[model samples]
Target chain A: MLLLQCPWCGDRSEEEFACGGEGDIVRPLVPEELDDRAWGDYVFMRRNEKGIHFERWRHAHGCGRWFNVARSTVTHEILASYQVGDDRPELPE
Target chain B: MSRARHEPLAHLALAAAGETTGPDAGVTLQAAPYQPAVILRGESGNAAFLEAFRAGMGFDLPLAANHVNSHAGATALWLGPSEWLVQSTTGQAEHGRLAAALTGHRHAIIDHGDGQQIIRVSGPRARDVLSKLCPLDLEGPDLAPGRCARSILARCSILLHPLPGGGYHIHVGRSFADYVWRLLADAGLEFGVAIGGAG
Candidate 1:
Protein backbone atom coordinates (compact mmCIF):
# COMPACT_ATOMS: atom_id res chain seq x y z
CA MET A 1 0.00 0.00 0.00
CA LEU A 2 1.25 3.50 -0.84
CA LEU A 3 1.80 5.72 2.18
CA LEU A 4 0.84 9.41 1.88
CA GLN A 5 1.84 12.14 4.30
CA CYS A 6 -1.03 14.56 4.60
CA PRO A 7 -0.11 18.19 5.16
CA TRP A 8 -2.40 18.23 8.19
CA CYS A 9 -2.82 14.58 9.30
CA GLY A 10 0.76 13.40 8.83
CA ASP A 11 1.74 10.15 7.10
CA ARG A 12 -1.10 7.73 6.40
CA SER A 13 -2.02 5.00 3.94
CA GLU A 14 -3.41 5.77 0.47
CA GLU A 15 -6.75 4.28 1.42
CA GLU A 16 -7.58 7.27 3.59
CA PHE A 17 -7.07 9.73 0.72
CA ALA A 18 -8.79 10.57 -2.54
CA CYS A 19 -6.84 11.66 -5.64
CA GLY A 20 -8.14 14.90 -7.13
CA GLY A 21 -6.84 14.59 -10.73
CA GLU A 22 -5.06 17.91 -11.41
CA GLY A 23 -4.18 21.02 -9.45
CA ASP A 24 -4.23 24.81 -10.07
CA ILE A 25 -6.64 25.00 -12.96
CA VAL A 26 -8.05 28.49 -13.41
CA ARG A 27 -11.23 29.15 -15.31
CA PRO A 28 -11.45 31.84 -18.00
CA LEU A 29 -12.61 35.21 -16.67
CA VAL A 30 -14.69 35.75 -19.80
CA PRO A 31 -16.26 32.62 -21.24
CA GLU A 32 -17.61 34.62 -24.19
CA GLU A 33 -14.03 35.31 -25.38
CA LEU A 34 -13.21 31.62 -25.91
CA ASP A 35 -14.08 29.51 -28.95
CA ASP A 36 -15.35 25.92 -28.77
CA ARG A 37 -11.84 24.43 -29.12
CA ALA A 38 -10.41 26.68 -26.42
CA TRP A 39 -13.24 25.82 -24.09
CA GLY A 40 -12.82 22.12 -24.91
CA ASP A 41 -9.08 22.35 -24.26
CA TYR A 42 -9.71 23.89 -20.86
CA VAL A 43 -12.22 21.20 -20.04
CA PHE A 44 -10.36 18.13 -21.30
CA MET A 45 -6.61 18.79 -21.39
CA ARG A 46 -4.14 17.55 -18.75
CA ARG A 47 -0.34 17.49 -18.67
CA ASN A 48 -0.15 13.83 -17.54
CA GLU A 49 3.61 14.25 -17.34
CA LYS A 50 5.92 11.26 -17.56
CA GLY A 51 7.93 12.24 -14.52
CA ILE A 52 7.00 14.64 -11.73
CA HIS A 53 3.32 15.59 -11.79
CA PHE A 54 1.57 18.11 -9.61
CA GLU A 55 -1.90 17.10 -8.37
CA ARG A 56 -4.36 17.67 -5.58
CA TRP A 57 -5.22 15.13 -2.92
CA ARG A 58 -7.85 15.17 -0.24
CA HIS A 59 -7.44 13.39 3.07
CA ALA A 60 -10.86 11.87 2.68
CA HIS A 61 -10.83 9.78 5.82
CA GLY A 62 -8.25 11.65 7.84
CA CYS A 63 -8.10 15.40 8.47
CA GLY A 64 -10.18 16.09 5.37
CA ARG A 65 -7.80 18.72 4.03
CA TRP A 66 -6.87 19.20 0.39
CA PHE A 67 -3.20 19.66 -0.48
CA ASN A 68 -0.70 19.51 -3.34
CA VAL A 69 1.68 16.66 -4.09
CA ALA A 70 4.55 16.26 -6.56
CA ARG A 71 4.96 12.63 -7.62
CA SER A 72 6.72 10.65 -10.33
CA THR A 73 4.23 8.81 -12.49
CA VAL A 74 6.77 6.09 -13.37
CA THR A 75 8.21 5.47 -9.92
CA HIS A 76 5.06 6.44 -7.99
CA GLU A 77 7.42 8.38 -5.75
CA ILE A 78 5.98 11.42 -4.03
CA LEU A 79 8.68 14.05 -4.38
CA ALA A 80 7.05 16.72 -2.22
CA SER A 81 3.85 17.76 -0.50
CA TYR A 82 2.53 21.12 0.66
CA GLN A 83 -0.66 22.84 1.74
CA VAL A 84 -3.17 24.08 -0.82
CA GLY A 85 -2.29 27.78 -0.68
CA ASP A 86 1.43 27.25 -0.18
CA ASP A 87 3.97 27.57 -2.97
CA ARG A 88 5.30 24.41 -4.61
CA PRO A 89 8.64 23.21 -3.33
CA GLU A 90 11.81 23.56 -5.44
CA LEU A 91 12.46 20.14 -7.00
CA PRO A 92 15.94 18.84 -7.86
CA GLU A 93 17.07 18.84 -11.49
CA MET B 1 -31.58 18.47 24.73
CA SER B 2 -31.77 15.30 26.83
CA ARG B 3 -29.52 12.48 25.67
CA ALA B 4 -31.43 9.97 23.60
CA ARG B 5 -31.08 6.26 24.27
CA HIS B 6 -30.19 4.89 20.87
CA GLU B 7 -27.65 2.15 20.16
CA PRO B 8 -26.97 1.08 16.58
CA LEU B 9 -25.55 -2.29 17.57
CA ALA B 10 -28.16 -3.13 20.18
CA HIS B 11 -29.49 -5.94 18.01
CA LEU B 12 -26.22 -7.81 17.66
CA ALA B 13 -26.03 -10.85 19.96
CA LEU B 14 -22.97 -11.58 22.08
CA ALA B 15 -23.20 -15.37 21.75
CA ALA B 16 -22.41 -14.94 18.08
CA ALA B 17 -19.80 -12.36 19.07
CA GLY B 18 -16.90 -14.72 19.22
CA GLU B 19 -15.69 -18.31 19.11
CA THR B 20 -13.59 -17.89 22.26
CA THR B 21 -14.76 -16.23 25.45
CA GLY B 22 -12.81 -15.57 28.64
CA PRO B 23 -11.51 -12.78 30.79
CA ASP B 24 -8.17 -13.19 29.05
CA ALA B 25 -9.55 -12.89 25.58
CA GLY B 26 -7.19 -11.03 23.29
CA VAL B 27 -9.91 -8.56 22.37
CA THR B 28 -13.02 -7.50 24.25
CA LEU B 29 -15.47 -5.60 22.10
CA GLN B 30 -18.45 -3.65 23.37
CA ALA B 31 -20.71 -0.76 22.39
CA ALA B 32 -20.10 2.19 24.64
CA PRO B 33 -23.02 4.25 25.96
CA TYR B 34 -23.92 7.33 23.92
CA GLN B 35 -22.50 10.73 24.83
CA PRO B 36 -22.84 14.27 23.48
CA ALA B 37 -20.56 14.88 20.51
CA VAL B 38 -20.04 17.83 18.18
CA ILE B 39 -17.84 19.04 15.35
CA LEU B 40 -16.44 22.49 16.11
CA ARG B 41 -14.90 24.65 13.39
CA GLY B 42 -13.09 28.00 13.58
CA GLU B 43 -9.95 29.80 12.52
CA SER B 44 -7.13 28.61 14.75
CA GLY B 45 -4.95 31.55 13.74
CA ASN B 46 -7.38 34.03 15.24
CA ALA B 47 -6.35 35.02 18.79
CA ALA B 48 -9.88 36.10 19.63
CA PHE B 49 -11.22 32.69 18.60
CA LEU B 50 -8.66 30.84 20.68
CA GLU B 51 -9.11 33.05 23.73
CA ALA B 52 -12.87 32.88 23.55
CA PHE B 53 -12.73 29.10 23.19
CA ARG B 54 -10.32 28.60 26.08
CA ALA B 55 -12.24 30.93 28.38
CA GLY B 56 -15.59 29.35 27.59
CA MET B 57 -14.71 25.66 27.30
CA GLY B 58 -12.27 25.58 30.21
CA PHE B 59 -9.60 24.03 27.92
CA ASP B 60 -7.39 25.27 25.19
CA LEU B 61 -7.97 24.21 21.61
CA PRO B 62 -5.48 21.56 20.50
CA LEU B 63 -3.53 23.24 17.65
CA ALA B 64 -1.28 20.39 16.65
CA ALA B 65 -2.46 18.09 13.95
CA ASN B 66 -3.99 14.78 15.15
CA HIS B 67 -3.67 15.94 18.74
CA VAL B 68 -6.38 15.60 21.39
CA ASN B 69 -6.90 17.61 24.57
CA SER B 70 -9.47 16.97 27.29
CA HIS B 71 -10.99 18.52 30.39
CA ALA B 72 -13.26 17.09 33.05
CA GLY B 73 -16.16 16.24 30.76
CA ALA B 74 -15.08 17.34 27.28
CA THR B 75 -12.34 16.20 24.92
CA ALA B 76 -11.29 18.16 21.85
CA LEU B 77 -9.99 16.14 18.93
CA TRP B 78 -8.18 17.97 16.18
CA LEU B 79 -9.67 16.84 12.91
CA GLY B 80 -8.03 19.49 10.73
CA PRO B 81 -6.22 22.78 11.02
CA SER B 82 -9.55 24.55 11.57
CA GLU B 83 -11.78 21.70 12.69
CA TRP B 84 -12.20 19.50 15.77
CA LEU B 85 -14.39 16.75 17.11
CA VAL B 86 -15.43 17.46 20.70
CA GLN B 87 -17.46 15.11 22.79
CA SER B 88 -18.40 14.46 26.39
CA THR B 89 -15.96 12.35 28.36
CA THR B 90 -18.75 11.49 30.79
CA GLY B 91 -22.34 10.32 30.37
CA GLN B 92 -23.61 13.86 30.78
CA ALA B 93 -24.63 16.01 27.80
CA GLU B 94 -21.87 18.47 26.93
CA HIS B 95 -23.17 19.94 23.66
CA GLY B 96 -25.25 22.56 25.40
CA ARG B 97 -22.18 23.83 27.15
CA LEU B 98 -20.37 23.78 23.82
CA ALA B 99 -23.11 25.71 22.03
CA ALA B 100 -23.31 28.25 24.82
CA ALA B 101 -19.56 28.82 24.95
CA LEU B 102 -19.13 29.88 21.32
CA THR B 103 -22.25 32.03 21.18
CA GLY B 104 -20.98 35.15 19.34
CA HIS B 105 -17.68 33.99 17.94
CA ARG B 106 -17.25 33.49 14.16
CA HIS B 107 -17.37 29.68 14.52
CA ALA B 108 -19.43 26.65 13.72
CA ILE B 109 -20.65 23.82 15.95
CA ILE B 110 -22.75 20.89 14.83
CA ASP B 111 -23.88 17.76 16.64
CA HIS B 112 -21.75 14.72 15.78
CA GLY B 113 -23.60 12.16 17.91
CA ASP B 114 -26.37 11.87 15.34
CA GLY B 115 -26.39 8.21 14.26
CA GLN B 116 -22.74 7.83 15.21
CA GLN B 117 -21.41 5.16 17.58
CA ILE B 118 -18.27 4.66 19.61
CA ILE B 119 -17.30 0.98 19.74
CA ARG B 120 -15.09 0.12 22.70
CA VAL B 121 -12.42 -2.47 21.99
CA SER B 122 -10.10 -3.45 24.83
CA GLY B 123 -7.77 -6.17 26.09
CA PRO B 124 -4.24 -7.31 25.32
CA ARG B 125 -5.06 -7.99 21.68
CA ALA B 126 -6.63 -4.62 20.99
CA ARG B 127 -3.70 -3.28 19.02
CA ASP B 128 -3.30 -6.47 17.05
CA VAL B 129 -6.88 -6.53 15.84
CA LEU B 130 -6.70 -2.83 14.96
CA SER B 131 -3.48 -3.26 13.02
CA LYS B 132 -5.14 -5.93 10.93
CA LEU B 133 -6.94 -3.20 9.00
CA CYS B 134 -5.33 0.12 10.07
CA PRO B 135 -2.22 1.33 8.22
CA LEU B 136 -0.47 3.42 10.90
CA ASP B 137 2.41 2.03 12.96
CA LEU B 138 0.66 1.42 16.28
CA GLU B 139 3.82 0.36 18.14
CA GLY B 140 5.61 3.69 18.11
CA PRO B 141 6.77 5.20 21.40
CA ASP B 142 4.55 8.26 20.94
CA LEU B 143 1.44 6.11 21.29
CA ALA B 144 -0.47 7.02 24.42
CA PRO B 145 -3.83 7.96 25.86
CA GLY B 146 -5.50 10.78 23.86
CA ARG B 147 -3.50 9.72 20.82
CA CYS B 148 -5.99 9.39 18.01
CA ALA B 149 -6.24 9.33 14.20
CA ARG B 150 -8.74 9.00 11.39
CA SER B 151 -8.21 5.84 9.34
CA ILE B 152 -9.90 3.06 7.46
CA LEU B 153 -10.87 -0.12 9.28
CA ALA B 154 -12.08 -2.83 6.93
CA ARG B 155 -12.55 -0.13 4.27
CA CYS B 156 -14.77 1.97 6.53
CA SER B 157 -13.66 5.38 7.78
CA ILE B 158 -13.25 5.44 11.57
CA LEU B 159 -11.96 7.79 14.21
CA LEU B 160 -9.69 5.77 16.54
CA HIS B 161 -8.78 6.82 20.05
CA PRO B 162 -6.42 4.87 22.31
CA LEU B 163 -7.43 5.45 25.92
CA PRO B 164 -5.19 5.62 29.01
CA GLY B 165 -6.19 2.19 30.31
CA GLY B 166 -5.04 0.37 27.15
CA GLY B 167 -8.48 0.27 25.63
CA TYR B 168 -9.48 1.70 22.23
CA HIS B 169 -12.53 3.73 21.31
CA ILE B 170 -13.46 3.68 17.64
CA HIS B 171 -15.94 6.28 16.41
CA VAL B 172 -17.66 4.97 13.35
CA GLY B 173 -20.60 5.94 11.16
CA ARG B 174 -23.84 4.23 12.12
CA SER B 175 -24.25 2.41 8.82
CA PHE B 176 -20.73 0.92 9.01
CA ALA B 177 -21.07 -0.21 12.64
CA ASP B 178 -22.06 -3.81 11.93
CA TYR B 179 -19.38 -4.25 9.29
CA VAL B 180 -16.57 -2.95 11.50
CA TRP B 181 -17.72 -5.05 14.47
CA ARG B 182 -17.94 -8.18 12.35
CA LEU B 183 -14.53 -7.47 10.86
CA LEU B 184 -12.99 -6.99 14.29
CA ALA B 185 -14.70 -10.07 15.62
CA ASP B 186 -13.52 -12.10 12.65
CA ALA B 187 -9.97 -10.78 12.90
CA GLY B 188 -9.79 -11.47 16.64
CA LEU B 189 -11.09 -15.01 16.37
CA GLU B 190 -7.62 -16.53 16.30
CA PHE B 191 -6.55 -14.50 19.32
CA GLY B 192 -9.86 -14.88 21.21
CA VAL B 193 -12.74 -12.39 21.18
CA ALA B 194 -15.09 -11.46 23.97
CA ILE B 195 -18.20 -9.46 23.23
CA GLY B 196 -19.99 -7.48 25.91
CA GLY B 197 -22.97 -5.11 26.12
CA ALA B 198 -23.14 -1.37 26.52
CA GLY B 199 -22.39 -0.16 30.01
Candidate 2:
Protein backbone atom coordinates (compact mmCIF):
# COMPACT_ATOMS: atom_id res chain seq x y z
CA MET A 1 0.00 0.00 0.00
CA LEU A 2 1.24 3.45 -0.88
CA LEU A 3 1.87 5.86 2.01
CA LEU A 4 1.25 9.50 1.14
CA GLN A 5 2.37 12.30 3.44
CA CYS A 6 -0.31 14.92 3.88
CA PRO A 7 1.01 18.45 4.26
CA TRP A 8 -1.16 18.93 7.35
CA CYS A 9 -1.80 15.41 8.69
CA GLY A 10 1.61 13.87 8.08
CA ASP A 11 2.11 10.44 6.47
CA ARG A 12 -0.93 8.23 6.12
CA SER A 13 -2.07 5.34 3.98
CA GLU A 14 -2.93 6.15 0.36
CA GLU A 15 -6.44 4.92 1.07
CA GLU A 16 -7.04 8.18 2.96
CA PHE A 17 -6.36 10.31 -0.11
CA ALA A 18 -8.01 11.00 -3.49
CA CYS A 19 -5.85 11.71 -6.54
CA GLY A 20 -7.07 14.85 -8.30
CA GLY A 21 -5.29 14.25 -11.60
CA GLU A 22 -2.56 16.54 -13.03
CA GLY A 23 -1.53 19.63 -11.16
CA ASP A 24 -0.93 23.28 -12.25
CA ILE A 25 -3.75 23.29 -14.76
CA VAL A 26 -4.73 26.93 -14.64
CA ARG A 27 -8.09 28.04 -15.98
CA PRO A 28 -7.92 30.51 -18.79
CA LEU A 29 -8.36 34.14 -17.83
CA VAL A 30 -10.61 34.89 -20.82
CA PRO A 31 -12.83 31.90 -21.57
CA GLU A 32 -14.76 33.69 -24.34
CA GLU A 33 -11.54 34.51 -26.21
CA LEU A 34 -10.50 30.85 -26.50
CA ASP A 35 -11.28 28.85 -29.64
CA ASP A 36 -13.02 25.47 -29.58
CA ARG A 37 -9.69 23.64 -29.98
CA ALA A 38 -8.11 25.57 -27.17
CA TRP A 39 -11.10 24.91 -24.93
CA GLY A 40 -10.99 21.22 -25.77
CA ASP A 41 -7.32 21.09 -25.00
CA TYR A 42 -7.82 22.72 -21.64
CA VAL A 43 -10.71 20.46 -20.77
CA PHE A 44 -9.35 17.08 -21.87
CA MET A 45 -5.66 17.25 -22.65
CA ARG A 46 -3.20 15.84 -20.07
CA ARG A 47 0.55 15.25 -20.11
CA ASN A 48 0.22 11.68 -18.79
CA GLU A 49 3.99 11.84 -18.52
CA LYS A 50 5.64 8.48 -17.85
CA GLY A 51 8.51 9.96 -15.84
CA ILE A 52 8.24 12.40 -12.97
CA HIS A 53 4.84 14.06 -12.85
CA PHE A 54 3.15 16.76 -10.80
CA GLU A 55 -0.28 15.75 -9.52
CA ARG A 56 -2.90 17.02 -7.09
CA TRP A 57 -3.92 14.90 -4.14
CA ARG A 58 -6.53 15.52 -1.48
CA HIS A 59 -6.28 14.14 2.01
CA ALA A 60 -9.90 13.02 1.81
CA HIS A 61 -10.09 10.95 5.00
CA GLY A 62 -7.59 12.97 7.02
CA CYS A 63 -7.15 16.72 7.38
CA GLY A 64 -9.00 17.41 4.09
CA ARG A 65 -6.16 19.58 2.78
CA TRP A 66 -5.19 19.61 -0.89
CA PHE A 67 -1.49 19.48 -1.83
CA ASN A 68 0.77 18.89 -4.81
CA VAL A 69 2.92 15.79 -5.17
CA ALA A 70 5.86 15.34 -7.52
CA ARG A 71 6.16 11.62 -8.15
CA SER A 72 7.84 9.36 -10.64
CA THR A 73 5.14 7.41 -12.45
CA VAL A 74 7.52 4.58 -13.33
CA THR A 75 8.98 4.05 -9.85
CA HIS A 76 6.07 5.50 -7.81
CA GLU A 77 8.65 7.38 -5.79
CA ILE A 78 7.39 10.65 -4.36
CA LEU A 79 10.03 13.21 -5.14
CA ALA A 80 8.43 15.93 -3.08
CA SER A 81 5.13 17.06 -1.66
CA TYR A 82 4.26 20.71 -1.21
CA GLN A 83 1.37 22.92 -0.28
CA VAL A 84 -1.14 23.88 -2.97
CA GLY A 85 -0.16 27.52 -3.44
CA ASP A 86 3.59 26.81 -3.51
CA ASP A 87 5.51 26.73 -6.77
CA ARG A 88 6.13 23.35 -8.38
CA PRO A 89 9.42 21.74 -7.41
CA GLU A 90 12.32 21.77 -9.92
CA LEU A 91 12.35 18.43 -11.65
CA PRO A 92 15.53 16.34 -11.54
CA GLU A 93 17.34 15.58 -14.81
CA MET B 1 -40.42 23.80 24.54
CA SER B 2 -38.09 20.84 24.94
CA ARG B 3 -36.98 18.37 22.28
CA ALA B 4 -35.48 14.91 22.46
CA ARG B 5 -31.94 14.37 21.24
CA HIS B 6 -30.16 11.05 20.89
CA GLU B 7 -26.44 10.43 21.11
CA PRO B 8 -24.73 8.54 18.30
CA LEU B 9 -24.10 5.40 20.30
CA ALA B 10 -27.67 5.17 21.55
CA HIS B 11 -28.44 2.14 19.41
CA LEU B 12 -25.23 0.22 20.01
CA ALA B 13 -26.85 -1.99 22.69
CA LEU B 14 -23.62 -1.80 24.63
CA ALA B 15 -25.25 -2.53 27.96
CA ALA B 16 -26.90 -5.70 26.66
CA ALA B 17 -23.88 -6.84 24.67
CA GLY B 18 -22.50 -8.28 27.91
CA GLU B 19 -19.09 -7.69 29.46
CA THR B 20 -15.80 -8.50 27.78
CA THR B 21 -14.60 -12.11 28.03
CA GLY B 22 -11.22 -13.92 27.90
CA PRO B 23 -8.43 -14.04 30.44
CA ASP B 24 -6.49 -11.15 28.89
CA ALA B 25 -9.31 -8.69 28.31
CA GLY B 26 -6.75 -5.99 27.66
CA VAL B 27 -8.99 -3.24 26.35
CA THR B 28 -11.80 -1.11 27.76
CA LEU B 29 -14.13 0.90 25.57
CA GLN B 30 -16.51 3.67 26.55
CA ALA B 31 -18.77 6.05 24.70
CA ALA B 32 -18.16 9.70 25.37
CA PRO B 33 -21.58 10.47 23.99
CA TYR B 34 -22.67 14.03 23.32
CA GLN B 35 -19.47 15.68 24.48
CA PRO B 36 -19.44 19.03 22.73
CA ALA B 37 -17.29 19.34 19.58
CA VAL B 38 -16.79 22.54 17.62
CA ILE B 39 -14.98 23.20 14.33
CA LEU B 40 -13.19 26.52 14.23
CA ARG B 41 -11.65 28.06 11.13
CA GLY B 42 -9.47 31.10 10.87
CA GLU B 43 -6.22 32.00 9.15
CA SER B 44 -3.38 30.90 11.37
CA GLY B 45 -1.22 33.74 10.13
CA ASN B 46 -3.70 36.34 11.33
CA ALA B 47 -2.43 37.72 14.61
CA ALA B 48 -5.89 38.88 15.57
CA PHE B 49 -7.28 35.43 14.95
CA LEU B 50 -4.69 33.83 17.16
CA GLU B 51 -5.21 36.38 19.92
CA ALA B 52 -8.99 36.02 19.84
CA PHE B 53 -8.76 32.25 20.07
CA ARG B 54 -6.34 32.43 22.96
CA ALA B 55 -8.38 35.04 24.79
CA GLY B 56 -11.60 33.12 24.38
CA MET B 57 -10.45 29.50 24.75
CA GLY B 58 -8.02 30.17 27.60
CA PHE B 59 -5.17 28.66 25.57
CA ASP B 60 -3.20 29.40 22.45
CA LEU B 61 -4.27 27.57 19.32
CA PRO B 62 -1.67 25.00 18.43
CA LEU B 63 0.00 26.08 15.21
CA ALA B 64 2.08 22.95 14.97
CA ALA B 65 0.50 20.28 12.80
CA ASN B 66 -1.03 17.28 14.62
CA HIS B 67 -0.59 18.94 18.02
CA VAL B 68 -3.24 19.47 20.70
CA ASN B 69 -3.61 22.06 23.43
CA SER B 70 -5.42 21.00 26.56
CA HIS B 71 -7.08 23.17 29.20
CA ALA B 72 -9.04 22.49 32.31
CA GLY B 73 -12.37 22.29 30.55
CA ALA B 74 -11.50 21.78 26.91
CA THR B 75 -8.93 20.65 24.35
CA ALA B 76 -8.14 21.94 20.88
CA LEU B 77 -6.78 19.65 18.16
CA TRP B 78 -5.20 21.13 15.09
CA LEU B 79 -7.01 19.88 12.02
CA GLY B 80 -5.34 21.93 9.29
CA PRO B 81 -3.66 25.23 8.61
CA SER B 82 -6.92 27.05 9.25
CA GLU B 83 -9.06 24.52 11.02
CA TRP B 84 -9.29 23.10 14.54
CA LEU B 85 -11.58 20.82 16.50
CA VAL B 86 -12.39 22.05 20.00
CA GLN B 87 -13.90 19.56 22.39
CA SER B 88 -15.11 20.14 25.93
CA THR B 89 -17.66 19.03 28.46
CA THR B 90 -19.24 22.49 28.54
CA GLY B 91 -20.51 22.34 24.96
CA GLN B 92 -22.96 25.22 24.59
CA ALA B 93 -21.06 27.67 26.74
CA GLU B 94 -17.79 26.98 24.98
CA HIS B 95 -19.34 27.49 21.55
CA GLY B 96 -21.10 30.66 22.67
CA ARG B 97 -17.93 32.23 24.02
CA LEU B 98 -15.88 31.41 20.95
CA ALA B 99 -18.56 32.64 18.58
CA ALA B 100 -18.84 35.88 20.43
CA ALA B 101 -15.08 36.35 20.61
CA LEU B 102 -14.51 35.71 16.91
CA THR B 103 -17.30 38.03 15.88
CA GLY B 104 -16.47 40.34 12.95
CA HIS B 105 -13.23 38.44 12.39
CA ARG B 106 -12.65 36.36 9.27
CA HIS B 107 -13.50 33.16 11.08
CA ALA B 108 -16.09 30.41 11.33
CA ILE B 109 -17.36 28.55 14.36
CA ILE B 110 -19.41 25.46 13.66
CA ASP B 111 -21.14 23.66 16.50
CA HIS B 112 -20.74 19.95 15.93
CA GLY B 113 -22.28 19.00 19.24
CA ASP B 114 -24.54 16.26 17.98
CA GLY B 115 -22.89 15.58 14.67
CA GLN B 116 -20.05 13.43 15.97
CA GLN B 117 -19.16 10.96 18.72
CA ILE B 118 -16.04 10.30 20.78
CA ILE B 119 -15.07 6.75 21.66
CA ARG B 120 -12.41 6.28 24.34
CA VAL B 121 -10.30 3.15 24.22
CA SER B 122 -7.64 2.49 26.87
CA GLY B 123 -5.65 -0.34 28.41
CA PRO B 124 -2.42 -2.21 27.97
CA ARG B 125 -3.41 -3.64 24.59
CA ALA B 126 -5.32 -0.61 23.43
CA ARG B 127 -2.70 0.30 20.86
CA ASP B 128 -2.77 -3.22 19.54
CA VAL B 129 -6.48 -2.99 18.82
CA LEU B 130 -6.05 0.30 16.94
CA SER B 131 -3.12 -1.07 14.92
CA LYS B 132 -5.47 -3.60 13.33
CA LEU B 133 -7.55 -0.94 11.58
CA CYS B 134 -5.28 2.12 11.39
CA PRO B 135 -2.28 2.28 9.08
CA LEU B 136 -0.44 4.75 11.38
CA ASP B 137 2.49 3.54 13.44
CA LEU B 138 0.93 3.88 16.90
CA GLU B 139 4.19 3.14 18.69
CA GLY B 140 5.97 6.13 17.21
CA PRO B 141 6.96 9.08 19.41
CA ASP B 142 5.05 11.47 17.18
CA LEU B 143 1.76 10.15 18.59
CA ALA B 144 2.68 10.73 22.20
CA PRO B 145 0.38 12.45 24.69
CA GLY B 146 -0.93 15.92 23.84
CA ARG B 147 -0.74 15.06 20.13
CA CYS B 148 -3.48 14.12 17.71
CA ALA B 149 -3.72 12.96 14.12
CA ARG B 150 -6.31 12.56 11.41
CA SER B 151 -6.28 9.17 9.66
CA ILE B 152 -8.44 6.47 8.14
CA LEU B 153 -9.49 3.66 10.44
CA ALA B 154 -11.54 0.77 9.17
CA ARG B 155 -12.16 2.80 6.01
CA CYS B 156 -13.71 5.66 7.95
CA SER B 157 -12.35 9.11 8.74
CA ILE B 158 -11.18 9.38 12.34
CA LEU B 159 -9.40 11.93 14.50
CA LEU B 160 -7.12 9.96 16.79
CA HIS B 161 -6.07 11.54 20.11
CA PRO B 162 -3.62 9.55 22.16
CA LEU B 163 -4.36 9.77 25.86
CA PRO B 164 -1.74 10.46 28.51
CA GLY B 165 -1.87 7.07 30.22
CA GLY B 166 -2.43 4.99 27.11
CA GLY B 167 -5.19 4.23 24.59
CA TYR B 168 -6.95 6.77 22.38
CA HIS B 169 -9.98 8.98 22.04
CA ILE B 170 -11.33 8.51 18.52
CA HIS B 171 -13.71 10.99 16.98
CA VAL B 172 -15.87 10.10 13.98
CA GLY B 173 -19.05 11.26 12.31
CA ARG B 174 -22.20 10.31 14.20
CA SER B 175 -23.30 8.01 11.40
CA PHE B 176 -20.09 5.96 11.56
CA ALA B 177 -19.90 5.58 15.34
CA ASP B 178 -21.45 2.13 15.49
CA TYR B 179 -19.38 0.81 12.61
CA VAL B 180 -16.19 2.02 14.25
CA TRP B 181 -17.19 0.57 17.59
CA ARG B 182 -17.87 -2.82 16.06
CA LEU B 183 -14.61 -2.76 14.15
CA LEU B 184 -12.68 -2.04 17.35
CA ALA B 185 -14.57 -4.68 19.25
CA ASP B 186 -13.86 -7.32 16.65
CA ALA B 187 -10.22 -6.35 16.61
CA GLY B 188 -10.06 -6.58 20.38
CA LEU B 189 -11.77 -9.96 20.61
CA GLU B 190 -8.58 -11.91 21.20
CA PHE B 191 -7.52 -9.55 23.95
CA GLY B 192 -11.10 -9.23 25.23
CA VAL B 193 -13.08 -5.97 25.20
CA ALA B 194 -15.46 -4.32 27.62
CA ILE B 195 -18.20 -1.83 26.78
CA GLY B 196 -18.89 0.77 29.42
CA GLY B 197 -21.60 3.37 29.95
CA ALA B 198 -21.42 6.77 28.41
CA GLY B 199 -19.22 9.32 30.13
**Candidate 1 lDDT, tens digit per residue, B160-197?**
88888778899999888989888998999888888766
Cα RMSDs of all predictions? 2.3, 1.6
lDDT of 2 at B51: 93
- Interface DockQ of candidate 1: 0.87
TM-score of each: 0.93, 0.95
TM-score of chain A of 2: 0.94
Pairs of colliding residues, candidate 1: none
Report the lDDT tens digits of candidate 2 across residue range B1-199: 9788887777867767756676567898988857777899899999998998888778999999889997868889998888999888665447888888888789988988788888999978899999999988899877999899888898889999998877799998889999998899889888988776664
CA deviation > 4 Å runs, candidate 2: B16-18, B90-92
Residue B56, model 2: Cα distance from true site in angstroms: 1.8
Q: lDDT of all the models against the reference?
A: 0.84, 0.86
